[model samples]
Each structure stands twice: as C-alpha cells, then as structure tokens.
Target chain A: MSHIRIDNLTKVYMGRRSRPRNIHDPEEHFGDNILVLNDITLGFEEGEMVCILGPSGCGKSTLLRIIAGFEPPTNGTVRVGGQVVSAPSDQSIFVFQQGGLFPWMTVYENVGLGLRHIRDAATKHERIQEYVEMVELEAFEDYYPHQLSGGMQRRVELARALAVNPDLLIMDEPFSGLDFLTHMKMREEVVNMHEFLRKTTLVVTHDIDDALIMGDRIVVLSGRPSAVKLMHALNFPRPRDFEKNPGLSRLRSEIFLMLGVPYAV
Target chain B: MKQHNDGEPTMKDNPEQAPDSGNRSLRLGLLSLLVIILLWEVLARGTGWSVHIFPDPLTVVFSFVELLRDGTLLRHTVASLFRVTAGFYLAVCLGVPIGIVLGRSVNARSLFNPIIQFLRPISPLAWIPLAMLWFGIGDPPAIFLIFLASFFPMVVSTTIAVQNINPTYFQVAANFRFSYQETLTRLILPAIIPDVVTALRMTVTIAWLVVVAAEMIAVQSGLGYLILDARNALRMDYVMNGMIVIGVIGLLLDNIMKRLGDVESSKWGIQAR
Candidate 1:
C-alpha cells in the first residue's frame, strides 16, 4: 500500500461563480461547470520526494490541494496511511507559494505554532529553535516576516511547516517569485532537507530541470481536464548534471518535446 | 556649487540632518501660531467691533486663568471626560466583537448588515429626543447619545478590517490546528489591531463631538454647559476659553490614539494599509 494514494481523482468545478474562466479546453465546459482534473490516479511512497510538473494553470495545484485536503475532489478519494483525507490537518502541512507567514508574528512564534500543543515550555522552545536552525535562520528568530527578504520569508515558512513533523509536506510553486540565485538556493535547501528528513514530500513546479534534479519520481500532468502525461522514476544519482550525464540530457530533451516545446536547448 | 553642497554631506551626514529637519518644523509651527495670534490681536483692537462680541486673545487668556484658578475648567472637563469614556468603552466592548462576528460569518453579516446600514446613516443628534425620553436628562442620556454616535462607526470599520484580513492566514491557522479561541486571539485580533486603532481614533473624535452637543441639551456639568452658561451671561471670553480647552483635549486624544498604531505587533498592519 502506498503512503498516499490518490485514486481515480476527478474534480469538476460546478456553479456559475465557482467555474474558473481559465479553462484551456472549451469542449469540457458545460453550462455553469468546468472540468479541472479527469481520472487522475497516482500514489506516493513513504519518504518519497515526488515533483509534479505541468503546463501553467494545468490543475497541478488543484491536485496538490486535494492531496493536502485543502479542497475536496468532486469524485474519487485521497487516502493517507489507510485514512481518508477530508480536511486540512496537522498530519499534512501545506506551504503556500509566498507570504503565508503571519505578518504579526516573529519567526520564532511562527515556527512555534506547531509546538503550541506541547505543554512543556522548554521542549517547545527547543523544537522551535531546532527547526529554525534547520533552515539556517537562528540569527533571525526575533524578526517578523515582513522584515525579512523574499527568500528568508520562504525559509521561515519552511521552518514553520517542518516544525510540526508532518507525515507529508506539500509545496505549491514554492520558488515562483524569488530571484534567480535565491530560487536556486531555496531549491537546493529543499532538496537537502528532503534528503535529511526523507518525508513524503510533493512539490508542484513548472520547471522541468527542477523536477529532474529534485524529484525521486517525476510526474508530468497535461493541460485542463488534466490527466497523467508521464510518471518516471529518476534513478539518476545525486548531483545530477545534464551536461555531464548523457542520459539526463536525453531525458530532459524528451520531456521538453513531450510538453510540446520544439527543442530542449 | 550644488554638487559641492551635496558632496559635503555624504551618507555619514544624513542621520544628523534628520533631527535638524525635525527641529526646523517645530520652530516653523510655533512661528505660525504666533502670527495667527498677532493677526487676531490686531483685528480685535482695530476693528472697533464690540469687545463683548469678539473678545481679544489677552482677555480670553485672563478668563482662562480665572477658570483654571477656580477649578471650574477642571470640573467641567472631568465631567465631559467621564461621559465620553463611559460611552466609548461601552461601544467598543460590544461593537468590536459584533464586528468580528459579522466579518467572519456570512450568515451574521447577512442578518445584521442591513439593519446596521439603515441605522448608521441616521445622525446621533437625531436620537437626542428619543434618548432624553428614554433616559430622562442626565449622564445616562448624554452617555447614551455618545454611545450611539460612536458605536456604528466602530462596528463598520472593524467589520471592514476583519473582512480585509488575508484569507491565507486563516488557512495557515487551520493547517496548524489552531482552536477557535486561538484563531480569534492569535489570528483575528492581531490582524485587526492597527485598523482597530485607526477606527478607535476616528470614533473617539465623533464621540467627543457628540459629548459637547449632548451636554448642551441633556447634561449640566460639561464643557458644553460651560460655553452655554457663559453665553447666557454675555461672557464671550469664557466661551472662547471653553473652545480652547476642547480643541487642546481633542488634539491630545488624537496623538495618543496615533501612538497605538506604532506599537511593534500592530505596525505591520499599519504599514500594509
């Protein structure tokens, strides 16, 4: 049995107001209804780092949101460890794209949110400090989210999420608004953290190279009324380099072609 | 020459210039006040208008001293302060929580918003007759009028503030398993503090405005009564004294309320606005 199983997931947004106008397929639009995801079945193994890639606005986030239990699927079910996922729980934490850290709370307080259940003060403080240090933000424990840079804010959010020791960590377009260098650094940090923790991590991204470099298994999703386009396990060793490795280079070109891009380079 | 002037003060000199600019503004403000007093003195003495109708600044200052010496000013000011405090506190206690409820729950907003909107436009002064009839002329009636003046604005502003809070924070709160009480205390309250402070500042001003009006009709021992009493006695200087005191106190209240938005936890909300 998989650690997380998304079985035959189908999400159709109903009602006039609920229907999004960003539908790529006009054929799928019925009156006051639009289909988002269609019969998508996938499973994530325990401690597996899965990167989901798709075209922009291709319902990748909807799928991730469903898995994290932020939104319900119109049909089909998402189960985690034999339990059906229904509502957002501390067992699975979702890190938003950006600016999710409470503006009013300092980094220490934000990270301590998960540890709020612990009655012992010293233990809670220790847990907060441990996660803060994990993200290399020990010097900024007292700083508020708005005081930090974009990358540092993301780090604080990451620390806040990881502090809970959730069984599954889901990130949606985590590096979208960051600068080039900051984005690469954050990507490296996430990969390193996943390597150390080996938690069931699902990352939704648009960058193919990011999926190739970070994912233990990479799943590509197609456009609206999305279904699984490809799911391949990347057994390529760590420090994967497309330039140095011919196989990775070939796979990158294949994925680019699969996504309808003419050439990789 | 301009380049040389700029070159003299590099980054090292910028900090020194900040306080210099502040001191300059303070001096200019005082000078402006002096000019206004001078203009008023010239107009009062040269216009040949009845001194009874428009007393000179010197005469008003003398009356101000007399009122202070007799403690009449203190007593009246205290009385007015008491009514405003009682009514404003009552409104805040009830209005803020109701506002949060309306902001959070669609059902509560739907049920209450129309009634609030209908009542909000009707002036607090319009309630003067009803308030006198109900509470019958004293601190109760005056305070009731002030409460009416401040309550609707407090509720409306707070509701807007809470509704404007980022929906992402609620999602974060749920993801962390924040209990209902924790959500209110840790999320809702802090998120709205800066806005609440601003609402409070404006509402307190309205309450102060109504306090004087309410006192002119309903009560006997406030600054408003002092002005009315002075008017009947044909002592224009005393009336001017009452106006000065009210203006000073209003300024002080505004400054204090402004400081609330500067507090560390609330500053984020202020800056976002």
Candidate 2:
C-alpha cells in the first residue's frame, strides 16, 4: 500500500445562491452547487516529494486540504498508513500558503507550538531551538511574524511545521508570495529538507520550473472540476538545470503547452 | 522653507520625522488650550453676571483649590474611579467569555445576538429607575448602571474581534493538535487582545460617562453628585471644578487604555510598529 492514498476523491461545494454561468466552465453549476473536484485518485509513496501543479482555482489546494483532513471529501477516502483520515492531526502537518505564524507569538513561541505536548520544558526548548536553527532563524527567535519579512515568516512557518516531526508534510503554495531570490532560495531549502528528512512531502505550486526542479514526481491537474491530467516522474539528479538537461527542458516546455501558455522564451 | 520641510520627507524618512511633527503638534495643542482659556475668561467677565451664576476661570480655579483643600474633590474623584473600575472589570469578566462563545458558535450567536442588540441601544440612563428599584439607592445601582452602559459594547466589540481573527490561525491550531484549553488561551484569547483592549478603552469611557449620571440619580458621592450638590448650593465655580476633575480623570483613563494597546504582543496585526 502507498504511504498515503487518495482514492476517487470528489468535492462539491454547496453554494448559497446561483452564480452567473462561468463561460469557461459551462457544466459546473447544478442547482446552486458547484462541482470542484472530480474523481481525483492519487497515491504517495513514502520519502517521495510530489508537486501538484495546476491552473489557478483548480482546487489543488482544496485537494491538499482534504488530504490533510482539514476538510472532508464529498466522495471517496484518503487513507494514511492504512488508517482512514478523518481530521487534522500531528501526523500530517500543513504549511499554509499565506503566512500562518501567529502574529502574537514570537518565532520561538510559534515553533514551540509543535512541542507543546512535551512534558519536559528543557526538551521542548531544545527541540524548538533545533527547528529554529534548521530554518536559520536562531537570531530572530524573539521576533513576531509581522516584524519579519515575507521570506523570514515562511521560514518560521516551515520551522513550526518541521518541529512537529510529522510523517507527512503538506504545503499549499508555500513560496507563492516570496520575491524571486527568496523564492529560489526557499525552493532549494524545501528540496534539501525533503532530501534530508525523506518525509512524504506534497507541495502545490503554479510555477512549472518549481515542479520540475523540486518534485521527485510531478502531478499536473487540469482546470475547474479538475482531474489529474499528467503524472511524470523526474528521476533527475540534484541541481537540475534546464540548460544542461534536454529531457528536463523538453518537459518544461511541454508543461507550458499543456497549460495553454506559449513557451515564447 | 515650511513647504520644503513638509514635502521633502519621503516614506523612508517617516520614522525620523515622527518626533519633529509630534513636537510641533504638542506646541500647537498648548497654543489652542491657551486660546480656549482666554475665550472662556473673556466670556465670563463680559457676562456681568455674579460669580455664582457665571464664575470666571479665576473663581473656578479658587473653588478648585478650596475643594482640593477640603478633600471633597479627591474623595469624589476616588469614588468615581472606584465605580468605573468595578463596573468595567465586571463587564470584561462576563462580556469577553460570552463574546467568544457567540463568535465561535453559530447557534449561540443566532440565539443571543438579537436579544443583545435590542438591549444594547436602550440607554443605561433609561435603566436608572429599574436599577434603583432592584438594587435600591446605593453603589450597587450606580455600579449596575455603569455595567449596563459598558457591557454591550464590550460584548459586541469582542465578538467582532474574535470573528475577525484569521481563520487560518484556528486551522494552524488544529493542525498542531492544540487542545480545547490551549486553543482558548493560546489562540483565541491572544488573537482577541488587541481588539479587546480597544473595546475596553471605548467602553471605559462609556462607563465613566454613565457613572456620573448614575451618581446623580442613585448615589450621592461621585463627581456627578458633587456637581448636583453644588448646583443646589448655587455654586457655579464648584460645578466647574467637578467638570474639570471629571475631564482630567477621563483623559487619564483613556491614556492608560492606550498604553494597554501599546503592549508588544497586542500591537500585532493592529499597527505597523
């Protein structure tokens, strides 16, 4: 059995009122209910980094949320290590797309949240320090989320999630709001972290390059009422570069074509 | 030169420029106070009425010293402060928990929201007759009136604050397996502190306003009673002295609440600093 299995997952959001017909999604609405996910069946192997890529509003995050047990699937089941997922738990920690570090808490306090169950104060402090150091945020342990820059806040969140030592790590567009340099750096850090920890990590991203470089395997999802369009394994070695690898370059362009974006560059 | 100074400071320079502008405003504020006092003195003298009817600022000052010397001013001020503190604490203790419940539970909100709204706007002054009937003429009725005046705003503001908390924070709390108690203390309470402090600041003012009125009706020791008793004696200067004390105390209460807002953790998500 796979480490995590999402079988025939479907989500239907009950709308409050009738929405105007979306020209692109003509078949979406049926009596004030919008079909969001249509039969999303996927599996994750232990120690594999899977990147879910899709167009905006494709319900990729919704799928991630379901897998994390933050929301229930309208149909089908997500089983983790042979147990059915019913609610959010420490076994699967989700790093939110937006800044989720508690605004009121210092970085040390936020990271300490994962270790709150530990009875030994010294042990909890040590673990928090370890995670903070892993994120290279030891100097900012006393800083609040709002006091940090966008990239630093993401690091705090990453530290907080990693401090949980979860079996499954799920991130929803974790580096979405970062600047270009910070985005590249965070991508490298996430890939390195995955390599080091070998946790079953799943990330949702809009950037194709991010998927190609960081994912051990990439799952492409189609637009509204989204279904998995393509699933490809990268098997490429670390420090993957489109310039040096013809296969990676071809795959990158292919993704752009599949997403209906011209590979003009 | 003035235009140059005002226009040259860029966004990056705002921190450095803050103190200069703050100093200028303070000077302007003092100038405005002086002008207002001068206008009041002119009006007092021009009225040609006896000091009992329209006392000049000097007579009011003298009466302030006399009231101070006799200790009535201090006694009345302390009385008023005690009532405000008692009533304010009572409202906070009851209102915040109720607000949290209303905010978190849709059922509770639907059940109690309408009743709260209906009671909220009925002036505490209007409740004086009922309060006196229930508690009799003493501190209880006056305190009850202050509680009524402040409670609704506290509940409403706290409820809104809790509701306004980023849903993401609760999800984060859940992901980390935060227990019910931890969620309340660590997540819900701290998240609401900034807004609650602001609500307290506003509610305390409302409470202060009601205490005076409450004292006028149900009690005879607060600044409001002092004002009423002075009016009976036809002592306009004493009335002005009571007004001045009330205003100064009100200003002090607001400043203290503002300091609560400036606490490091509570300033989060509320302001840049």
Candidate 3:
C-alpha cells in the first residue's frame, strides 16, 4: 500500500522588491521571482526502498525536504499515511548528507539523544544498546564524534535514525563522503538493516551503482526544477549479493545510460 | 603512545622509572624565583637609585606582610571579589538568554540590535558618575559598572556563536519532533557551549577591570580604594603592595577561568592546549 503521497507540489522564491529612491516619482511594481520547483507528484509504497537519482541541481534535495516537511511547498500538498505534512513529523526522519552527530555527545549518547525524553528509562537504555550493537559501534560507544572516524559517525547517525523507529526514513546521499571500501560496506549494512527492520526508506543519490545495490525501486529525476523521468522496479530477491550477481551490473549500466553517462565497464 | 625524552627529565617524566626526575621541574621553577629575588636585592643595595622612589622588593614584601597582619588587605580583597562575582553572575544571567533570543529570531535581532549597538561603545568607567548618581556610593554602583562592562561582550559573542551553528543540527532536532524550548535547551545551547565559555572568560577579565575602576571612584572599601588611599597618604609601599595584590589576584582568577574553559571545552570534544 502506498504510504506517502506527493500531489502537484510547486515552490517559487520571491526576490526582494526594489524601491525607488525618489518618493515623488513612484512607478508601478510587478512581481519578480525565481521558480525553484515546478509541479511535481509521486507516491511510494510501504516497506519499499526507493532511490531518487538526479543531477546536482535537479531539486532532488528540495523535494526530499518538502516531503520531510523541513520546508513548505508554494502550492500543493505532501501526505504521509493520510495526514498532510505541514512541518517535520516523527514518522518521517531525515538523514543528512553529512552525519549531523552532536559533537558534544559520545556514540552511545548521540544514538540515545532522541529517545532520552521517553519516560521509560530501561526501555530507552535497551533500545540504545541494541541499536549501537546493531551498527557494530559497541566498542566505540564511549567515544565522542570527533574521536571516531568519519564512517563510524555515519553509522551512529544511521543508528540514531533507526532507533527512532520511523515509518519512513529519508536519506540524502548519506554514504557519499565515505571511502570506496567503507561505502560498499555501508551499502551492505544499510540493506541488511532494511531487510531486518522492514521499514520504508527513500534514498536520494547521484551514484547509479548505489541506487542499484540499495534500491528496491529507482526513480530518476531530470535537470533543474526536477520531475520524475523514469521508475524501474528491481526483481531481485532479499539479501542480494552484488559481488556475485551479474544482473546487478546490467541494471547499473541501464541506469547510467538513462542518466546520459557512459558505462565504464 | 611512546614517550620520548629529548632533554633533561623533569617532573612530567614517568615517576615509576625516574624517581629523581619527578621533582626536577618544580626545583627549577623555585630556583628561577630565587634568582629574580637575588637580582632585585642586589639592585636595591648596589644602585644609586633612590630607595623611596623604587623601594627594595623586600620592602614591598614587608608592606604586604604588614597589610595582611593588620587585616586591611583581606577586607579589601574580599570586597573587590564580592563586587566582581555579583556583577559577573548578573551579566551571565541576563546576557545569555537575550543573546540566544536575538540569535534565534530575526525579529528579536532587529528589535534589540540598535539599542545594543548604541550602548556597546560607551565605556564602563564613563558610567561611574551616572552609577554614583543612581545607586549612591557603595558596592551597588561599583557592581553596576562591572555589569555594564561584561554584559555587552558576553551577549555579542554568544549571539554570533548561536547564529553560526549549522542548520543541519536544527533540522535533525525538528525531525525528532523536538519542541522549540527543547531544541534551544538541548541542541542550541550544547552546540554553542565552547563559544559561551570563551565569552565567559573574556567577561570575567572585563568585569575585573571595570570593578577596579568603579571602586577607585565610587566605593570606600576595595583593592582600588586601597591604592587610592595609599596614594593620598604618600605611602608608596602600600600602593605598590596593593598593585601587586591586584596583579596576583587577577592572575589567579584568570587561571580559574582558563581551567573551567578547558574542562567545558573538552566535554564538547574541543582539544585545549
């Protein structure tokens, strides 16, 4: 069943209006503005991992922000589970491109931060430990964000989002900053976590291989003032091994071609 | 992880292996002080300079002992310390919230910015006459001057720190469904803690300066009053003693502030040198 619905959303930013220095000679004013997002509409099913692939300035992040309710659309509406999203909701959590772990907090503290206000302390502690262990950060739980390496901090952020138990997880190029081996490992771990939790996720990225490996369905967006270009459903089974699967490479090539980029191999 | 010794081993050396080196740095520091004292003694006895003009360091030390014995120094030090503490606490209580509000809301900034800017450059010492007229000759006027000195810098620095916080942190807080107050208390305050600590250290120093100046004019009992009294009586030794006491107390307070800043900054993952 579709869990999220985006209906004819539009955003326009009005520039500051200039005034005449001479008050006696006033001229009639016309509205001058920049159109950032044209009308866009899409939907996503529950428990589905959807990748939004687009170019840098394609308004992909803005669209994700609108759905996450960080910013309101100039027109139209975004609904999650039949409720209109006017502001950020606990049901839809956003994972930023940079792991926004609080520098003052240790790995354990950062993961536990959102759950700290819960009246049940024992449950909160257990949940924090479970998520920390799940992310393989048990050894580094006491270390502050700066003390840990970049990849470890990212894992902490992921653990934090997962611990909240949101209905939909929104990721904006979460693994893009990691080194090659770490990136591959992160992809595998994220997929593993998704399968275990069975939570709906929407991922936005520019990497075709990343989309193929992690996405259950891929939505391609065109250039500036982005609109959906194509949607491809993956027929692969759960816990698919990308290294051993030859079909995954073919899908990567198809996505690259669709994005007007030549496939390297 | 490996410890390397490039020079003479000192008190910082590993005590298990180097028992003799453990006290070496302490001994050196003591020896340096003795050398300075001996040089001063030689200059006092040997030079043709007037003994009254630049009294022997021993004379100054003796005057310090005499003031302590008479209990006057203690009373003055306590008075100065009290005024500074009261003023600094007041600044912290009022300045931080105003700063946070201005930093968070554009409307608050627009409303408060002009008034703050107008008052910022007015010297705290210049307020002494007005403070005297309003508060009368006591600790109140002195404290008011100190508060004026410390408040502006603290608020301004805090506002800058809050304004510069990464927006991503706020977004994360909102995604967690945090209320406005929770966001400010949990994320915003913690994020700017290091900067706030720095501002505090700076405020304390400014408060000290202002309090001393205020006490010189508006109050009858303080380190500043002691200096003025000594100058009026033409007892240069007491004046020198008061100045030395002020310098030492200022150093001690600054060190305390430094240690507090280090402790708080380290908690926020900032490495203090």
Candidate 4:
C-alpha cells in the first residue's frame, strides 16, 4: 500500500517581470512561464526510505516541497496516507537545506517545541531527551543554536523534526556543506534513527554518495523540466559502509552517464 | 553598538562567561568615577572659582548628604521613578504589539512609515504645552511626555525585527501545527528580543531624559524641580547635588536594564543572535 502518491505533478515558475500577477495589469501581461518539474509521479510504501537524486537546477527540492505540501503543483495531485495533501500538516515534517533552528531557543527547547502538544510534560520531556541524546547532543541541551557547530545545529533540526513523531520526513539537501567526516557521522545517525523509528523518509540530494549511503531506493532525475530518468534498488546489504565498498564507484559512473556529466575519478 | 547582549565568549581567555565581564566593568566604572571627582576637585581649587559658581566636589557631596538626611531626595526620587515607570510600561504594552502587526504586513508598513517618520522626529518635549492643557500639571503630563519618548523606538525596532525574520521559521511552525498564540509568544517574541532589548535601553534613557524636561516645565517635585529650585535660591551646591543625583540614577537604571537583558539572553545562548 502506498503511503504517499504523486500523480503527474507539474510546476511552472513565472519569471520575474515576465508576467503580470493578475488580469488587472493587461499591458504587462507576459506569457513566459519556466517549466521546472514535469509529470513527476512517484510513490513510496510505509517505513520505506527513498532518495531522489538530481543535479543542480533540476528542481528536486521543488519536488520535495510539493510533497511536503509547501508548494502546489500546477497539475496533478498528491496523497499522503490516502488523504490528499493540500497544506502542511503535523503528520509530515520538512527539514530545509538550512538547519532552520530557532536562534533564541536552546537545543532542548528547539527539540521540545512540538512535543508540548503531546499533552504531558513528563512524557514530552522524556521524548525530547530521547531524541536529543539520539543525536548525541545531550551535553549541549541548554546551549543555543549559535553556540553549537554547524553539524550540531543540523542535529538539533533533526531532533526537532523527530520529536514531533511525524509519519513522513522530507529532507532537502539537509547536509549540504558539512565536512566529509561529519557528513558520514550524520548519515550513519540518520540511518540508525530511521531503523529505530521506522518512519517513511524521502531525501532529495545532488550528492551521489548521499543517496548511496542511506537510501533503500534511488530515483534519478534529469535537468530542468526534470522527470524521473531512472530508479535503482541497491543489491548491497543494510547500512553498507561506502568508504570500503568496492561496488559503489560503478554505480556512481552509471548515474553520471545518465546525468550527461563527464565521469570524474 | 548593541551592547545589551548575552555576554558571551567575546574575550577568549575568560571562558567563565558573564561573571568576569560584569565584575570587571563594575570595577572600571568605580575607578572612573573616583578619577572624575578628583579632577573636578583639583580644577575648582586650582582655578580659585567662586563657591557659588563652581561649587567644588566636596560641596556637591555635602549637599547630597544634607538632602539624604532631610528625606527630600527620597521623595523626589520616588516621584520621578513613578512617572517614568508608568510611562515606559505603557509604551511597551502599546508599542510591541503594534510593531509586530505592522511588521507582518509590508503594505501596512509602507503606508504608515511616512506618518511614523513625521511624528518620530517631533521631540517629546515639544508636546509639553499640549500635554499640560490635556492632562494638567503634576504626574500625568510628565508621564505622557515619557511615554511619547519611549514608544517610538519600541515600535520601530519590533517592526524591523518581525520584518527581517527568516521565512523558514514560519514553515517549521506550520509543520508543527502551532497556534497563532504559540507562534507569537514562543517564536516571534523570542526572535525579536535581542533587537527589542537593545532598543529598550535607548528608550529608557530617552524616557529618563524627558522626565527631567517635563518635570522642569509641566510638573513639580522631582530631581528637575530640585535643580531649578536650588538655582533660584543661589544654592549652587544644591543644584550641583541634583545634577549629580540625575547622572548617578541614570547610570544605575541603565545598568539594571542591561543586566536584566543579559540574564534573559543567556538562557537562550546570546552568541547565536
């Protein structure tokens, strides 16, 4: 049974000054709409981890937004758990490219934000502590977002998202600029957290290794006006260590060729 | 420029956080005060100026002691404190919400900015004659002037704070299904505190300054009245004492505000702002 379904989704962006916003400005009415995503129909089952792999300017993030209910597609409908998603809901959480941690809140407060709705302070506190410790930020619970390293801030974001106990976690390049070591550590953390929670997760990333490390299934997307070009299931085992895996490079090249980029390394 | 901060690790060697910085500042301030008094004493003695005109530091000290003994200083201080407190509190109550509302709507801000700009520059003192006619002489007119002084900055800073908020915050808030009340009290208020508290110090200073001017004209029985009455009687030392009291009180109030802001900011980690 599909938990999320997108049927023939299409997004067209109006260029700046290219078109009038309303019919009142008839003289300024221009008809130049740039197509970003075309016929993007995809679905995933319960507890499945899916990664959408695409290059820059390919609108993968836009597609994630459409699923997160932050954006509306010009065509096609999206359903989450048999219900159409027209607006953002507590059932789905989106982690932005930026960590988006509230600067004025301590790590504990940031993580505990949504848990207040749980209606029991003791239970909420326990859940917050659980998620914060899961991300290895137990020591910095009282510290604010600015006091932590960039990676730690991202963990706070992750912790906050998880605290809500959402059914769907939509990530858009959540680890864009971290050093490789932190990236690997965080990826492992995400994998472990997913295993622990078994939430349906969808991550959109341009980094090929990001897709390979945590994704159960990878959906490749082409450039602008992008549609799914390929979908591959890894034959490798769970939590495979890509640093030592010999089979990873061949898959990387395959994706590169599909993306029309010259293979490097 | 915005010094009312969480007092973070700006000084690398002192990783002990707030206690060290606050102590050092207090020590430095006391030393500077002693040095200034010594300079005044020497200059008054060296110049051989008249006691009535250039009353020495000792005279000011003696006059302050005398006022303290008679209990007039307490009465005047309480009167002034009451006016400024009522006025500033009212301003905060009125200004912050209005600013947040205007901040949410850009069209509203643009529409109102010209009116705000026009009214902002008109000195609160300029309203005294009108305030006197409306509220009459005593605490009301002085409080009104102080209110005018503090309200504008609070509104302006809060508006800017709301206007400049990152859009991601709202998206996250939406994701969590927060109520309007939750978004304001938890997210919006905390987000604006750093900016709002910085302006808080400025508004307090302006309020204190206007209270003196308003008291000198529109009201009676305050430090301002003390200064004016002493001058009329040619009691130069008493006038000097009143000036000293105003300066010291202003410094004390400002320190109290900065300390309050620092304490609140530290809870949320000040450096991030």
DockQ of 1: 0.57
Interface RMSD of 2: 2.0
lDDT of 3 by residue, B92-140 (tens): 9999999998899999999999999999999998887789999998989
All candidates: CA RMSD (Å): 4.0, 4.0, 5.3, 5.8
State the lDDT of candidate 2 residue by residue for A150-237, as single tens digits.
9999999988999988989999999988999999999999989888999989999999999999999999999988999999888998
lDDT (C-alpha) at residue A245 in model 2: 95
Number of the top DockQ candidate: 3
Candidate 4's displacement at residue B95, Å, is: 0.9
Against the hidden reference, what TM-scores do the models get? Answer: 0.94, 0.93, 0.89, 0.87
Task: Give candidate 4's TM-score.
Answer: 0.87
Docking outcome class, model 1: medium
Compute the lDDT of residue A107 as modeled in candidate 2.
89
- C-alpha local distance difference test of each model: 0.91, 0.90, 0.84, 0.85
Model 3 / residue B113 / CA error / Å: 1.1
Using TM-score as the measure, name the better of candidate 2 and candidate 3: 2
**Model 4 misplaced regions, further than 4 Å:** A19-34, A136-143, A239-248, B1-25, B264-267, B270-273
Enumerate the candidates' DockQ scores in order.
Answer: 0.57, 0.56, 0.63, 0.57
Across all candidates, the chain A TM-score values are: 0.96, 0.96, 0.88, 0.90
